[model samples]
Target: MTLDPRLNAFRPDLADRRLEGQVEARHFVDGRPERVTVSSAALRREPRPDAAQETEALFGEDVLVFETTEEGWSWVQLQADSYVGWIASAALGPRGDGPTHLIAVPRTLLFPGPDIKLPPLMGLPMGALVTVTGEAEDRNARYGLTTPTGAVVTQHLAPFGGAADNFVTVAEQFLGVPYLWGGKTTLGIDCSGLVQVALAMAGIAAPRDTDMQERALGTRLAGIEPLRRGDLVFWKGHVGIMLDGQILLHANAHHMMTAREPLSEAIARTAARGSAVTSIRRLG
Candidate 1:
């Protein structure tokens, strides 16, 4: 029997070398390496630790990979922000298809057109990951979101200049939500997902995780005050959205998911924890 050439690419040995780079989730679109899938695994140096965070450099800097396997495990790498560590194979996926946008609001949706019939999810907020599948036609841009899920989630956002505008609305909706670890839904979300989902709604695509988002956005503001409507506020290991000049909204684990506070307040909150604000980026 002959195997389809497309199926041939699914083989693990097809990956010729052990690798190192920021591991990103997969997006289901036709682009080269679409943003989707969670990086659930890692290939480590040695002596794997029982705890994930205590493992050191295991989570953030985006360096994770594994050889293909029909079974549930694979080798891993931990190289987020130059800190390297290893984690389990179960955490990662063969296809990098997670989500391009993180949900900022308690609930949001994607649709085949700008209409509200095909909503999914059981009530969520904060860090829900949404992959864009399609867009509204000129006649229907005002009513719904057409997504890859083949379900129309909501129809409130007007399909305006690309998808960036959609992000702004999504960001606005999540005025408050709690943050959580390894979380990407409204139930709990981190700073970056707040920015990610907002941008995604505007028809622009980005990563679910913050570090990956920072790299993709490019260029940081010299000061937070100069940021635009869709700008992003980033801190060491955290991120958020810049609203107006004085405020930003996000689902902070410490603050609890979905809350709009002064950017200074957020900075102070992180500072209280001894984590200083790293930088803020203008994604728009």
Candidate 2:
């Protein structure tokens, strides 16, 4: 008998006997592009705009290589915690603008009025898109931006709208738009960007990222027990307004971007995704 090769080890066993065959690495993983090794990996609790995970180390059995073919399938070879999945190439790429300017390590500066470096935007890359909370003249730095991560970095930041009642109404105007990543305008917007700009228009300063936005609004709530028009409805990495007792309006990536989904259905989806009921901050 010939010795088994990596390509032959993957062959399915015929009857009870094993016949080795090598399986392409990407075949088992979901949403993989050209074949590539797992340069690094992480576990995400949820597959969403705001995915959070405690992170775990990689193991040889838990890894997969990307395929060289087109129209490839993804999703397999998951880690032990079952938090890892094959994400599409699009989502895997650098977020917010191109990668050239993402600083990864920005110069240290004081923020929110203090000479400190602990909170510096040193982690962000240049051209990384971030929501500006406001800027100020620090005793030590040129500028600082209150980042979507909610960190007050440096003193200089681009202008960002604040959260207030009026901004909620302004966001409503964007109903029925399409969802586009890295978009911050009415032309097209993702769940978080839509909320950010809409709130900006109304002068409601909300965070640029979904996780930060959730923290920026409302009291902790459960389900849709107390719903009303203008109440902020939180979903998996998305936010919407309670147009009435039964409806929510905001840009969504699941389907039609700017559309309305009933509170019950929306809530059910959140449960199905296994996320918690974060809150429902009223805007109007």
Candidate 3:
């Protein structure tokens, strides 16, 4: 039977007849639609602070609120990635409007006011979707965008649309960003996060994790085919994009940062560690 793509078995889908391994058909317990209010909210494995963080919900993203606990955590499934996890209840609010602009740059600061001299309200990572309320001129006559959080320079945002032509360039921008498990922001990002964000800016939709990405994105290359720019090479739990035929760019724990290296070197080093390249895909 074909299962719902979003059904990770944590949430009830009666038609699929599964919920965390139970085969009984059931209905949602207390599902409600909510919008993320914070810049980024952690989606944890359990409804507790010490639980492993599984993913994140960016500001303005909508989620299905399934259940809430007395400990102040709520089970939610992100609308974008359909990834389910527990998040702080305080980070969400009643459903709201969608986003108007996509954070195009690697990182942009949200200022408490229109002026840049003031302290920033928070920082938004690349690929964040934000709604613009109004526009005003900064001291230098540059356009400033007023959002729910505050203001950001107009240049930092782009109208949401098809992928850009420079995915490699976009990936290179996060060269020094630290590697974090389940992170999708410039503050700390995983290999999949780096690929997803870079491709997102270029107008392609990407799944949130390496395994899903390997299964869903791009066309598989033949065993003897030559690699080209934008090719995706994947191992068991890791992914890297080809900057060219010979160079691979990825966010890796080895360097503890995003870095580019020779593809041959990567394949050899990874093989030594017992994880060989499982597949290579090319996306249009």
TM of each candidate vs. truth? 0.50, 0.40, 0.90
Q: How far in Å is the alpha carbon of 244 misplaced in model 2? A: 1.9
Sliding window of 10 residues with minimal summed lDDT for model 1:
27-36
Reference-based lDDT, residue 263, model 1 = 82
Stretches of candidate 3 off by over 4 Å are 2-27, 147-149
Write down the lDDT that model 2 would get. 0.44
State the lDDT of candidate 2 residue by residue for 173-243, as single tens digits. 66766766534444455676666655544545565556666776666556547777667767656677778
Tens-digit lDDT track of model 1 for 1-284: 54322111122233212221222223211111111233122233332544333122111124334342454333333322222323454443333333444343345444434444545333323333444444454433342332333333334322223344356677666565556554444444456656655665565666545666777785777873566666677776777776677787676776677777788888887889888877777764
Angstrom error of the Cα, residue 227, model 1: value is: 3.9
Each prediction's total of clashing residue pairs, residues at least 3 apart in sequence or on different chains, is 64, 40, 4
Q: Is candidate 1 or candidate 3 better by TM-score?
A: 3
Q: Which candidate number has the best lDDT?
A: 3
Candidate 1 residue-wise lDDT at 137 = 46
Residue 213 of candidate 2: its Cα lDDT?
65
Candidate 3 lDDT over residue span 68-128, tens digit each: 7788998777887788788999999976456788788878888877788888888877777
